[model samples]
Target: MLESLNESKKLLPERVAEQIISLIADRELKAGDKLPNEFDMAQQLSVGRGTIREAVKILVSRNILEIRRGCGTFVCEKPGVVDDPLGFAFVKDKKRLGLDLCEVRMIIEPEIAALAAERATSEEIEELQRIEDEVKELCDKEEPHMHKDIEFHEMLAKMSKNMIMPNIIPVIQTGISLFINITDYSLTKETVRTHQMIVDAIRERCPQAAKDAMIEHLASNQDKIERLSGL
Candidate 1:
C-alpha cells in the first residue's frame, strides 16, 4: 500500500514520485514486477490519475521502471542503473579517458579477480570458461570480439559475489569499448592469452594466481595505451 501525499507540497508530481519509490522499497518489489494500474495506484496514493502518470514517467526516465505497450509498467532489470552513468560519451578525448579507465581498472580489477577466484561457484567458473573460449574463437577468426571481451570482464565482476561489483559494470564496459576503439584491437593474441590465463587461474580457484593474471592482462593494455599516447 502507498502513503497519501500532503496536498500542500509543491511539485506534487515529484512528491508523488518519491512516494511511489518508497512504496516500491516498502513492498520489496523485484525486477519485472508490475505495478498496480493507474486508477488503482492513484486511489491507493490518494492522488489524481494524472499525477500518477507524471510520477511513472519520471521513474521511467530514471531507469527505475519501463513501460510495455500491452503489458503494464514494471521494474527495470537493473533498477537505478543507467547505461552511461558516468557520462563517458560526453568526454572529447577518448584516448585519455581510456587511459584513465585503465588506471582505475588496474587499481580495482585485480582484487576483483581474486575475490572471484575465491567466491565463484562451479557453474560461474564454467560460464567464465565458455566466455573465454568465445573470445579466443572470435580472435582466431579475426572477427569482432569486443563484446565478448566486455562480457568476460562483466562475468568476473558477477563471480566476485559482491553486490556492488555488478553495478560498476557500466564503467568497465565503457572502458573496454574505448580501449578497443583506441587500440584498434591490436592486442588480439595478448587478449586471448591473458583471458585464458585469467580464466585458468579462476578455474583452479587460485586467488593469487588470478590476481596476478588479471594484473598482467591489464598491464598489457596499459602498456599499449602508454605507447600509443607517447607517454
Candidate 2:
C-alpha cells in the first residue's frame, strides 16, 4: 500500500519518490522484486504517471532501482549503494591511492572477517567457498581473475551480516582493482594462499584465525605497493 501525497508539496516528484521508497520498505521488497507498473503506482500514490516516472528515475540514479527494457523496474542487488561511493576514480595519484585504500582495509576488513566468522550462515560460507575456488582456478590458469577476486571479498563483506558492511563493498572493490593493477598480479600466489586461509578460518568459525588471515592478506598487498613505490 502507498500513501497519497499533498497537492501543495513543492516538489511532487521528490515527494512521490520518498513515498515509493516507503512503500518498498513497508512491503519488504527484496532485491530484484518488481515494482507495480507505472499506472498502478500512480493510482496508488495519487500522483500523475509523469511524477511516478520522474520519481523512478531518481531512485535509479541512487542505485536503489533498475529499469529493464521490456520488463520492469526492480531493486538493485546492493540497493542505495553507488558504484563509486568514495570517488576513488578522481584521484590523480593512483600509487598513493592504492596505499591509502590498503590502510583503510587493514583497519576494517580484519574485523569484518571476524564478524563474518561469527555470523555467516552455512549457506553463505559455502557460497564464499565457491567464489574462492573460482578465484583460485582463474589464478592457476593465469587468467584474469580480478573480478572473481573482488567477488570473493564482496562475499566476505556480505557474510559479515552487518547492515553497513555491504555498503563498504565499492571501497573494497576499488582497493582490489588498484592492488591488481599496481602489482600486475605479481602477488597472485600469495593472494590465493591467503584467500584459502581466510576461507578455511571462516569455515571452521575461527574468528581470530579469520581476522589474522584477512590482515595477512591485506598486508601482503600493502607490502607490494610499498616495494613497488620504493617507499
Candidate 3:
C-alpha cells in the first residue's frame, strides 16, 4: 500500500518523509486526504513511531500536511510550493514591481518564444492558436480576460519543452497578472494584435520573428503601464 524506506540509510526521518511523498504520489493522495496514523505508518515502513512522527513534522513544515487538533493530520488544499515564492509581499512599490515583472518577461519570453518556435509540435501550435482565438473573442466583447491572457503566455512557455521555463513562467506571471488585472493593462486591441503576431510567427516556424514579436509584445505592455502611471 505504501513504500518502505531503506533501513540502512542513516537519515531515517528524511527517508521516511520521502517514502511518504512516494505514497502520496503512488496512491494518488490529493489535497485533504487523510494519511495513516503514526502507528500504522511505523508498522508499514518498518520504522519506529518516533521516526514517523518526525517525518510527519517535516511534511507539516513543507505545507504537505496540516494538523487538526481533534481530527488528526490531513493534506493541505494546495501543496508543494507556496503561492508567492518570489516574496512579492515584501516589495512596497507596486509600480516598481510591475516594471520589474515587465523587465523579467522581456528577458525570459523572447527566448522562450524562439525555443517554442523551434521545438513546438503541431499539437502545441494548435493549442496556441486556440488560446489566441479565445483572447480575440474576449477582446471583441470588451471583456476582462486576464486569466485567458495569462494562459496564452503560459502555454507558450510550455511549448518551449523546457521543464524549468514552464515552472518559472507561472511564478513570474502570477506577480505580473496581479498588477495587470488590477489596472487596465490586460484587455485591449493592441494586446490581441501583439499576441496574434507572436502566435503567427511561431506557427510559421520563424524563430527570429517569434522572438521579436514576443519582445515587442511585452514592450508594449511596459509602455502602457508607464503611460498609465506617468512613470
Candidate 4:
C-alpha cells in the first residue's frame, strides 16, 4: 500500500499517471515507440484526454517521457533516476496533514455506508459478506488487515449501487494510511459490532436501519477523533 502511495505522492497527477507509468514499465513502452495519439490512449486507458495529458506532462518533466514536435512522446531508455517530487524522501507525515486527512475521511465514509445499505443488491451483499468474513479472519489472526478493510468498504460503496459513488470512494481510500485504529490491536468489539450491524442491516435491505447504524457508528468516532486531534 505504502509503495503504491510512495510512487503516487510523487506523481500527483492522478491514478492515470500511475496507470501510464505502470504500462510503460510493465508493457515496456520503449524509447521512440510512437504511442497511438492522445485520443486513442484515452480510450485505451478508459479515462478522459485531460487525465492523459496531465499524466504525460508529469512524465515529461520527470524525463520518463519526452514529447517531440508534431510526432509524439516516447518513453526514455534509461530515464536518469527521476528525482522524487519532494527530493526522494516524501515520507508520509503522521502529524498535522495525516490527522486532517483522516478527519475528512470520517465525514465521507459514513454516508457511503448508508448509501450502500440503501441500495445494495443480492450479489453485492454476498460479496460484502465475503469481504467481511475475510476481514474478520484477518483480524482474529491478528494480521494487518487494512487492505481487506479498504476492500470491504469499497465493495460496500459499490453495492450502494450509486453511480456517483465511484468517485467519492477513492477520496476515502486516500487517507486510509493513518488508520491506526484498523489493525487488530485497536480493533475493539464495538467496532466489530458496528460493522456487523451494517452488514446485517444491508442484508435485510433495511435502508434506514443501515443509515442509522452507520451514522451511530461513525458519529461517535468522528467526534472523538476530531476533538482529540482538534481537527
Better of 1 and 3 by TM-score: 1
**lDDT of the candidates, in the order given:** 0.86, 0.86, 0.85, 0.66
- Number of the top-ranking candidate, with TM-score as the measure: 1
The alpha-carbon lDDT assigned to residue 38 of candidate 2 equals 99
Q: Tell me the tens digit of each residue's lDDT in model 2 across 142-208.
A: 8888788888888888899887877786566675575445644688899999999999999899999
Q: 2 or 3, which is superior by TM-score? A: 2
lDDT of 4 by residue, 48-147 (tens): 6887899888778777788888888787754533543223134455444546555665666667777777777788888888888887877788777767
Expressed as tens digits, the lDDT of each residue in 176-203 for candidate 3 is 7675545543437788888999999998
**Global local distance difference test of model 3:** 0.85
lDDT of 1 by residue, 1-231 (tens): 567877665699888888888878988998999988899889988888999999999999989989998889999998888777888878887778877888889988999999999999999999999999999898889888878888898899999999888789657667557544545468999988988899899889999999999999999888987887777
lDDT of 4 at 51: 70
Cα-lDDT of candidate 4: 0.66
RMSD of each: 2.0, 2.7, 4.8, 11.9
| Clash number by candidate, in order | 0, 0, 0, 1
